[model samples]
Target: MAERKPIESWLTDMDGVLIHEGTPIPGADAFIKRLRESGKPFLVLTNNSIYTPRDLQARLSRMGLDVPVDNIWTSALATAKFLDDQRPGGTAYVIGEAGLTTALHDIGYVLTDHEPDYVVLGETRTYSFEAMTKAVRLINGGARFICTNPDETGPSTEGPLPATGAVAALITKATGKKPYFAGKPNPLMMRTGLNAIGAHSETSAMIGDRMDTDVLAGLEAGMQTFLVLTGLTTVEDTEQFPYRPTRTVDSIADLVDLV
Candidate 1:
């Protein structure tokens, strides 16, 4: 135990951290309401950057959640921030969705045709052979590889789909280069959310359901972490990873007592 600090602000992971598949986990909605009632600030951070804040709001609303747009954060946004910081005037050749394109554009990066300076990889419901070939070609040339996250798969009602990590692997096989991931376990993602929300690192907590990316990222970012078992991570999985989280609970329902 790393002496869990007195918590204040909150940065929570979506998908598993806040809800499962699409429904609010057990008591997730009530947890958010409690936070609102207590006047505590929290942001819903997610590695799934296929959708923007607005898109997420609509989707979550369909699932009976009452989250607002401003309180959402995504790895797509973080990837954009990373590229903006590293290369100020590079054209981006992306293989993600509209939200990713929008994020990069918002960060002042130009979308290009060929031989772009950067290749930003994200989740795509429709990854075609042509898209893969283009990405491989760009990486084979001189473009830097940037990924939203390295998750090989994401959870779903049916199962997991090939996540950005699978795409990164293909590019690596083609170009023999690893992409810079901008999601959890990468301190940049935490910095992006915390900075955006103007939250102090010490007072903030990263609440998630996965151990590898979410909890590890929180520890690396110097934030208290809470891991819920409702997602991909398991207690047995923790036995393998050496980095322990601040605490583990069944679901967001337990947050009522801790936070």
Candidate 2:
């Protein structure tokens, strides 16, 4: 491979790349600090829409990572942006928590189940059957389907729990309509992040742990992709995918110098 341009901007997935189950990954803090000190633009990207940027910032602060609220981007924000651009001030029947709902409201979207333009799905701690039923009925009634991400399951100490994608499947089966996901694996999310930072793809890099979502999204978005092994994906897992990240490292610790 030819020598690459020096990285001027950075994007990274939050859960697996920076932290795991609420603990900071080794060198993750230093990596973030380096970005801040060097004045390089960066954003911590996450498919999770359960919390707002403030909530995520507080969580990270508790874990000793001082990521600013603006430096964090969630699927909820991306979905809201997508909706606002697609149809400004549109109405939706939202199946999500404060994060998703708040983002929509911020973008001047009204949340309602009555004759909504879209049925928005997002990550929540509890996915109530009644809510799912309502969502299915709404979609069947002519509301469009929109999901934050296509992750089938989310990680937890108890094990994997059904995520937005799993519930989306049920809604699809009942309503015969599929949702347009606005999270990783969809280059739209990556492009949105890049635009937010005013960064060029050629001089930017995306750091992620998953081959399916993070790496693929970055690659498709025209950004250099790096895979960190501290999370869900393994070195062997890369071979399963047709595309590959620009480089792989055992942990974020190994990539600190590159920053």
Candidate 3:
């Protein structure tokens, strides 16, 4: 086979690479502004499937950062896309909120309160036994399983909240079946985002705080990876990472030179 060409588009991580705890990393806005001014395209990709692009835009604007809705893509959106590709006419039993549902609908997947062709697991504040039972029944009936992410917990200013992976694990335990995940570390989420935006792997890159999720996904996607120290990954954790990033910076400001 011919050697693959380099990436010509940029794919960036959201939480730690650009913002943390709803706060913009120092110079993140300016870095994006520069990219915008330079006519460079970069998508703000997040593993959080709880919100739509509009939701993320609103939240970022609240932090005094402005981002177009189309420039943002969530792992939930990618998961929905992946499922749609797998089973176009199938109905999905979702364990997430409106964002995930919106993504599924946008991708032409039917949402069913009854027996579904697929079971989708994600982060939710209103998880119910009813939903869990539905998922279990679906799995037992040979329905496909897909999860939005695998992050065990999400870092918050207060601490960590049970992430999608935690809830996914619960269902996994009940069903004794491993669910397919579509977020960082899996690479498919980043690949979906790249394909959606028509970004090339050679020019694309993932910048984030977590080594396991953000960086690993980039590596798997054959894109450059940059690690920032604003979130979960600490200095010591870097030493333990099985894979290292192409670059490491203290903050987004430190990466102002890259974009």
> What stretches of model 3 exceed 4 Å from their correct place?
1-8
- Per-residue lDDT value at 118 in model 1: 88
lDDT, candidate 1, 75-114, per-residue tens = 9988988888888767989998977998998888889857
Worst 10 residues of 1 by lDDT: 1-10
**Worst 10-residue stretch by lDDT in candidate 2?**
1-10
Candidate 3, TM-score vs. the true structure? 0.93
lDDT of 2 by residue, 119-228 (tens): 99999988999999999888888999999999999999898999999999999999889999999999999889889988888899999999999999999998899999
Model 1 pairs whose backbones collide: none
- Relative to the true structure, candidate 3 has a C-alpha RMSD (angstroms) of 2.5
Clashes of each: 0, 0, 3
lDDT tens readout by residue for model 3, 1-259: 3554444566777787788787788888887887677676778988888888899999998987777898898888888778878888679888897789898888888888576888888777777888888788888888878898898888777888888888788888988999999877887888778887777777787788888888888898888888888877887888996678887888888866666
Candidate 2's C-alpha lDDT? 0.94
Itemize residue pairs with steric clashes in candidate 3: 6-202, 7-202, 7-203
TM-score per candidate: 0.95, 0.98, 0.93
